[model samples]
Target: MKIIAISNQKGGVAKTTTCLNLAAYISKKKKVLLIDCDKQANLTKNLGMEGAKTSINDLFLKRKFDVVNVRKNLDLIPSSVDFVGIDLLIQGELARESILKKALDRLESNYDFVFIDCPPDMNLVTVNALTASNYVIIPVQATQFSMDGVNIMIDFIGGIRESINPKLNLLGILVTHFDKRLKISKSIEQDFKDNNWEMALFKTRIRRNTAIENSQHKDYRMTIFEYDNQSKGALDYSNLAKEILKLIKNLN
Candidate 1:
């Protein structure tokens, strides 16, 4: 199984959205598992699993945790608000960074892909995610601030690769919340090109769409594909899943 961490130290970059929709799209033909590592538990709440009895917190605490089957081929290990203090709890433990890697070693073999929805910070939890992942996907907005976050994540990943997971690789940088109608969007796209980031950028840009946001509303809580297959958000995620599959195939 290939483990991928959808991470960015910056918030409001659609990291949870990408993890949710991408896993939903790929689970159509492949076994997928999602690990909600964010303390906010947005991914868990969006999936309507907030009341889950067992969560990723249990896994980290070395207590019994359940793998919830949220969709046909998509399962999830939900997050807990308690996870906010997990870093402090695990800090004194031996080999603290490898805790997640060891836990995932037992759970990942059954799935084709495992996507981790990481928190919006470079902390112990994010480090654990990176250490356990085979690849990482950084999702960012077209704003300069988002680009700054991407640069920070790149440097952070370099440290992780050098000292922790030597096999870890960056899959690509995904542009999320993109809108061609905005001049700022065009400018950022140009900036990316000017920086010679074409090789590291994904061709699929997730457009800003209401359907995407509406799908995650409390009243609906549906995947983009399930909420509106014809929407641009669905199409983008579908294309992303295909691109990721092809990329992983070539990498392997």
Candidate 2:
């Protein structure tokens, strides 16, 4: 299985959104599993699985994960708020950074792809995600602060590669919340063009759409495709999934 971590050390950069949509789109043809490693449990709640009895926290604290299939071809290791204090427990533990990696090793062969939604920080939680991931997809928003976060994330990933997972590869940089009409968004795109991206900078930019946020505010948190397949948000994400699949094939 190809384990991919969708991470960005900045909140509201479409990290969870990208993770959910990509997994949902891919699950149509491939067995996919999503690990919500963020303590906030945004992905879990968004999928309407708010009260998960067993989460990634249990996997960390007990070394056991009870997988839940929210839909066909898609399984999830949900997250809980209890995970917020896990760093305290992880400290002083042997191979603390590899805990998630070890746990995931048990289930890797069951799915064609595994997507990890990491927390918006460079903490032990994210460390575990990176350690378990074979590839990473960074979601960069079209904002100045988001661009700065991208630079910080690069250095942080470099440190992880040197000390932990040397085989971890940066799959690509995905621009999210992009608005062609916005001058700032255009500038950010130009900045990425000028910057020396060591990895692929994806051409499928997720355009800013109200439907994306509306997915969460509904009765049951739904994905863009479920909310409105014809919407720009759904179309962009579908295209993104196709592009990612093509890229993966080429890389292999």
Candidate 3:
């Protein structure tokens, strides 16, 4: 399976939303496993899954991963607040960085893609996600602080590559909540083009749509495509999934 971490150490950048929806969309064509790596359990809540007996916390503590099948072709390893204390618990453990990698190794043949929804912090949990992932998709917003977050994440990913996973690569930078009518959004797009980072800035920009937020608020827990296929958010995410599939094809 191609393990991808949907990461951004910047809150309000749609990280959890992207991770949840992307996995949903990708699962339509491929068997997908979504792992909620954030202590806040936003992704878990987003899916309307509660009372998970075994979560990612168990993987860190006991090296046991019991996945919950939410639907056909889609499974999830939920997260809980207990994950916040894992750093202290695993202190000085041999190969702590690879704990997640080893857990995932057991399910190597079960999924076509594995998506990790990470927290908006550069903590050990995020480190474990990066160490275990083969690629990372950064969700960025059109804000000055978001740019700084992207730079910080780039440096952090580089450090992880240097010491932990040399093969980890950036899948792309996905622009979220993009508003074509807003000059600030346009400016951010222009800056990405001028900077020309080695990784791609995805062509599909997720437009601001109330449908997406409403679905989450209502606990619908479905992708925009499933909630409202005609919505702009659905179109954008569908396009992004196609682009990701193309990239995966090229990489192979």
Candidate 4:
């Protein structure tokens, strides 16, 4: 099984959305598991797990996590607000930052792709995500500051490499919330390609579209695309899945 974390130090950059969609795509035949590691539980909500119980906190605090099937071949480790204070407990209350790694190790092989939706910070919670994950998929917003925060993520990955997981690889920096017509977006896209990336960055960038927000209201996983494959957002993310599959195949 391949464990991947979808993360960005900056919030509102489509991290949770990407994780959900990616897992849905990978579940065509493979058993995929989506973990809502973020305290906000946006993933849980998007997956229609509102007010759900037996979240990751329950698992961490007492190994009582309940896995629920959100799709035919996909399962979710639902999350709740309790995870917000997890950093404090792991640091000042329990023991260390690596407990998440231990918790996830038990379920790693149960999934073909374990997709973690991470919070928008470099806190201990994120550290455990990095330590447990074998691949890191960064979702970079089209904004100017997105590039600035790349260095911090790189540094953190460096520390993880030196201390925790050397086999961990930078899967790619997925440019999210992209606006094709914006002068800055095109310029930044060029800059992203011209400069050195953390690794082989995916050429497919996710453009900002109301369809993604629309998915939130529809209670589905870009399933709108299945109905209307000609839609731009549909075509874009589907192409992304192809690109990502090629990457994973090479890794295997």
Q: What is the lDDT of residue 21 in candidate 1?
A: 95
Backbone clashes, each candidate: 0, 0, 0, 0
lDDT score for residue 10 of model 1: 85
- Report the lDDT tens digits of candidate 4 across residue range 112-220: 7889999998888888888888899887787554566876787788898889888788888888778878877777755655666634567898888777778767545
Better of 1 and 3 by TM-score: 1
Task: Write model 3 residue lDDT over 18-105, tens digit each, in one string.
Answer: 8877888888888999999888888888777767888988899899879998867999999987788787788779988889999998
**lDDT accuracy of residue 40 in candidate 2:** 91
Q: How much is the lDDT of residue 21 in candidate 4?
A: 75
Q: lDDT tens string, model 2, 108-171?
A: 5799999999998888989999999989999888754355677888888889999999989888
Q: Answer with 1 or 3, whichever has the higher lDDT.
A: 1
Query: lDDT of each prediction vs. the true structure?
Result: 0.90, 0.88, 0.85, 0.79
Clashing pairs in 1: none
Q: In model 2, state the lDDT of residue 51.
A: 83
Clashing pairs in 3: none
Error of 2 at 44 (Å): 0.4
Descending-lDDT candidate ranking: 1, 2, 3, 4
Q: What is the lDDT of residue 95 in candidate 1?
A: 88
The list of candidate 2 runs beyond 4 A from truth reads: 144-146
Q: Pick the candidate with the highest TM-score.
A: 1
Candidate 4 global TM-score = 0.91
lDDT of 4 at 20: 78
